[model samples]
Target chain A: MTDRVIRLQEAPFDYGAECAAFAERAGGAGAVVTFLGLVRNDGGSLTRMEIDHYPGMTEAAIDAIAAEAATRFRLDSLLVLHRTGPMQPGEPIMMVATASRHRAEAFAAAEFLMDYLKSRAPFWKKEHRAEGPIWVAARDADEEALDRWAGGAG
Target chain B: MRVLYFAWVRERIGRPWEDVETTAATPAALADELAAREERYAAAFADRRALRVAVDQRLVDFDAPLEGAREVAFFPPMTGG
Candidate 1:
């Protein structure tokens, strides 16, 4: 398997299986870090999450982000998978995994990957509530988080 | 060129995408042209600062040239994880 993987699919992924597979694919790396995002059910009022993504741009943006992470952290391997379309609250939305020779490298790379993915990726989310569906607004915090990496990473 | 819309932009624009031929030279110019065509587009492009543009599937400034671009997309800031 390639060291870097990026996937966008509507099908839900098996978390346990993905982790085990990623670990194996990472091979001799001494450290592996992972992150997962799930739909948040707001006070039981949230019913679903609808993710819309640009077909060609989604893959391009993720690949570019992953490449940057790998270059900054010297990671041995990385995995990014995100789902689009409707998903129930509590279902997985996206995940990131990084493997590096050291713990710091793996951890930093994972965070960098996440911060960039949050606001830079061409994916928009809409939350379905009892009243109506509202587009999830981009938070200033996420943009700030991404800028924090401008000083550099790893 | 194929002009694409996503998320709320798509909803407000009333369609996912459309083929547009224009003398507009940049994303900003194209937006202005679209906004003039219909009330829905005007509503969508009303707050230009609230939207982002991509030329040929890559993010770029609103003033980026679209000379050779085959596609253009407009949407709000991303909320992905």
Candidate 2:
């Protein structure tokens, strides 16, 4: 079984440090790919952002998604770290890394994880703008991305 | 069952979580029951298309049976990444 590090934490994490640690722990994997998501200022309109996540479901959903990625990609391992609660502009929101024997598989797995996390996970983002706060709407494009994976076309 | 709300659902409902007692057999039915209670609930659940539901941490259809279920969460489509 591949190793999986799925963390749904409120504290901010160092992206560089987490990536370095994940790669090192990949253990002979030929490739490691990482993706990081940051809170954008939205042209100075965003004051900050609040991430409200279901405490129980967040962990359960991410674990299931990571497991699916590992199986489908024949992955060596993966890392999923996401933040919750209030966050300032430019702060790191989340990161996912995938390790595999081939770069293609690693990259594919990372993308798959991100697509699922965008809609499947239980975290909701409320963007606090200077004018007011608004809940970020789920894009139809995101849900559509999962369709490609289900088609087995990668 | 324990009913949970998140995001704008929570904001509209004015609570994050609450204990709810209902004889409704499905999430859709439970929604109707709650919506009948208050205008806030009616507004929150006005459009079922904009919402999602989970039972015991797993996503399920609104018509999914709630027999023996312990937890139900209702929220808008997730914007997580």
Candidate 3:
């Protein structure tokens, strides 16, 4: 089976390179779906953001998450990348690419992977504003997003 | 034992990470030990309502035994990508 997960640092990611990697690994796949989550300006209000992650634990968590997504959606391939350390506005924070024989599985898996990554990964974001450095609160919306995918075995 | 904090939990506690020797055996016991360290850890865990625990690298309940666990991590509900 093709490797179905990618997780790494907060460095610049090449969309083209990721696409090529997916194409090379995905044999006989008819569809590929990808999602990119950028560090938004958040309406130009925020100043800076810092992402923290456990060294070994972070990768393990992402890998487990990716593996689960692949199984649940029966995907042909999956790629997930998460950045750590300081990030400025408009930078890429993470990406998820999914490949499958059909559009349904690819799309669902990509979306599901993103949702699960947001709520389950070992990432912590701290925001800087004009006022001062303020750590962000975990949102209720995030939990609700993950809840949409509940009932599948852990 | 080593106690690690992530994200805002680190901020509230005023440190990103700390290592403390504990007589406690499990993650929950470690948490209690930390909570007793000072007001900072206590306040950091003031409302465990949104906090999450992980032993080694896998997520587990607070009460999950820490047998043979080398590392324990405490943090808020994840808000990753």
Interface RMSD of 3: 1.5
Clashes (N, CA, C under 3 Å) per candidate: 0, 0, 1
Clashes of 3: 1
Model 1 ranges off by over 4 Å: A151-154
Kindly provide the TM-score of model 3 when superposed on the true structure, using C-alpha atoms. Answer: 0.90
Q: Which residue runs does candidate 2 get wrong by more than 4 Å?
A: A151-154
The 10 consecutive residues of candidate 2 chain A with the worst lDDT sum are A145-154
lDDT of each: 0.91, 0.92, 0.80
* TM-score list, all predictions: 0.96, 0.97, 0.90
Instruction: Estimate the lDDT of model 2.
Output: 0.92
Candidate 3 lDDT tens digits, B49-79? 7789888878899888887777788888777
Per-residue lDDT of candidate 2, residues A1-154 (tens digit)? 8899998888899999998999899969989999999998877999889999999788889988888887788798899999999999999999999999999999999999999999999989999887888999999998998998884321
Candidate 1 per-residue lDDT, tens place, A38-124, comes to: 898878999888999999899999998888887788899999999999999889999999998899999999999999899989999
Highest TM-score scorer: 2
Give the per-residue lDDT digits (tens) of candidate 2, residues B12-32: 999999999988899999999
lDDT of 1 at B48: 94
TM-score per candidate for chain A alone: 0.95, 0.95, 0.90
Q: Which candidate tops DockQ? A: 3
Candidate 3 second chain TM: 0.88
Q: Which window of ten consecutive residues has the lowest lDDT sum in model 3 chain B? A: B16-25
lDDT of 1 by residue, B1-81 (tens): 999999999999999999998989999999999999989999999999999999999899999999989999999999999
Q: Provide per-model DockQ scores.
A: 0.69, 0.70, 0.76
